[model samples]
Target: MIVLKNPHLSVHIDEMQGAELRGIYTPDARNALASYEWSSPTPVGRGASYGSSEMDWLSGYRGGWQETIPNAGQNCVVDGVELGFHGDASRTRWSIVDQGADWCTLETSTRLPIRVRRTMRLDPDRAVMYIEGHVVNESDLEIVFLWGHHPAFPSVDGGRIDLPDGCTIHPDVNRSGDLLTQDSPWPMAKTSSGEFADLSEQPALGSHRLLYVTGNKVGWSAVRQPDPYVSVAMSWDVAKHPYVWLWTMRQTPEYPWYGRASMFALEAQSAWPYDGLAGAKQRGQGIKIKPRGEESSWMTLAIIPNGSGTVTGVTKNGEVTFKSSEMH
Candidate 1:
């Protein structure tokens, strides 16, 4: 376990399991991250081999935050090249390149001629974490890949979700009941049962709702908790990562879920579903990387304190505003 610290927050990362963020804590809370209550023992050391995969990665799945490169969904084969879920980047061990009192940088390179470098920094007085990273294409050929961040946080029933202007729901990203292929504006959508289900709030028990957001001119998503009164607000570059996938899994009784765990994930990705590079190419959203090409973006997340309210907007300095309350 590698730990990065500051005055108000401490971020714990697990190097043994794909360098996932095991926990993100504040002074008031030990673990602000969402976790699964598995009856099974937590797996130690490295995970399964990429070749022996067909949706078995969740056998040892520990919910947290991880980076996905070139892929972000089920394992598949494209153009004779095999790709695994969320790709090998999250599964591979990352080495610490630099460290200091308030910040640390970790680096990893994948087999796809792409190298990723992520730097995490903390504010000394604020409850926030700043992330900066980039991908470099080492080969002469352009690489089409899905780059994103997956953070699973503790979501409560009735919590609210806020998105940017003109944001629309993506039907392909797994919806509950009969809302699978329906296209509707975010926050509120009519269910197949002729009832209006608020897509913005966390559903009741026994729900596995997945909502993806696209067509937004800006980049930001905030999950507001009504009980604890603290909300997590994330902001990034919409031009680079234009899509946001919001997933809530609760009481799923299938193989991996096993009717356990209650968590929500907010993903900021360059593209959609993890069908490998070919899938992005087919959607006409493939990024063309020239030889020695490099692309970069930054993200900021804050654990705002002391209020249960809706997030109206984020400032240029990364401070989230709760419309019902003041920033103090």
Candidate 2:
């Protein structure tokens, strides 16, 4: 394990194997990070040599392999066809294609029918991490999948989320088909300051985070601490993904992940209220590409050192624009 540390942040990367980020954040950020129990390492854990343990998880036949998709969900299946959760890209091992003081690239491919190249770059000076997902359809038939970025942020007491605009947020009906209510939209409105209206109840701040959905365009979300000592800002292109999932599971006694630590994940998702593939088929929002052609999407996450930073996105032609902010 290669550990990279600086005054502002610390990261662990594994070489030899596909270079992946094992740990991220500064020393002071440890308490929040360690509070939560991680199902697996940041990078997919793979062995140096191919063996039963390795093949059991990586291979499609074995049931022991935990799917690498984040934000608590399983594979998407429709009409007896299975679309692996969050796709198979994250679960597969990635190779270090390139690197630098502030940036690195990792590449991986799919087993069944698709080939994908995902690149992640981090710049401490700018306090930003850039992720690019590139997918190519190798088979003749069209392959349907869900593409999303799930970054779990550390949770703190009295921590609240900040959004760019006072946009309305709605949650999916729970298993019992009940809506979760909130007293107020934090950082925008006060919890005790107002009566319970249409918004869901303020999730008791815990190790579990929250999810919010935005419209297509640009938007930003921030997790603010009460002490003002630390804050994490996430921004992404709203054009490709308008919905964000805010997950918080601290109080639940049935699961071990409950309250281990809190993280406000700013997810960049291609669909809203449902998985990409399912949402597409249900709402006819599927993206179409020409044969042998390609589609690309990018998201930028900036962890402001002191309650400030910027997030932006650019096109293939280099046309760049701001996505969202809390940068004062």
RMSD per prediction, one decimal?
Answer: 2.6, 7.4
TM-score each candidate.
Answer: 0.90, 0.67
Worst 10 residues of 1 by lDDT: 41-50
What's the TM for model 2? 0.67
**Candidate 2 ranges beyond 4 A from true positions:** 1-8, 13-22, 27-74, 78-81, 175-202, 205-212, 227-229, 305-328
For residue 119, what is the lDDT in candidate 1? Answer: 86
Clash pairs (backbone) in predicted model 1: none
lDDT per residue (tens digit) for residues 1-328 in model 2: 5544455566555443333344566556642222232543222244342333223222321111111222113445554655455555545556767766555665666543555565656655654556676667666765554556655544445555555554555454442012343323422322233433222223554323343555435545655554544555666656555666655454443333333433444556665554436556577554444455566667655454443333243333222333355445
CA lDDT, candidate 1, residue 312:
70
**What lDDT, from 0 to 1, does candidate 2 have?**
0.47
Superposition error at 1 for model 1 (Å): 1.1
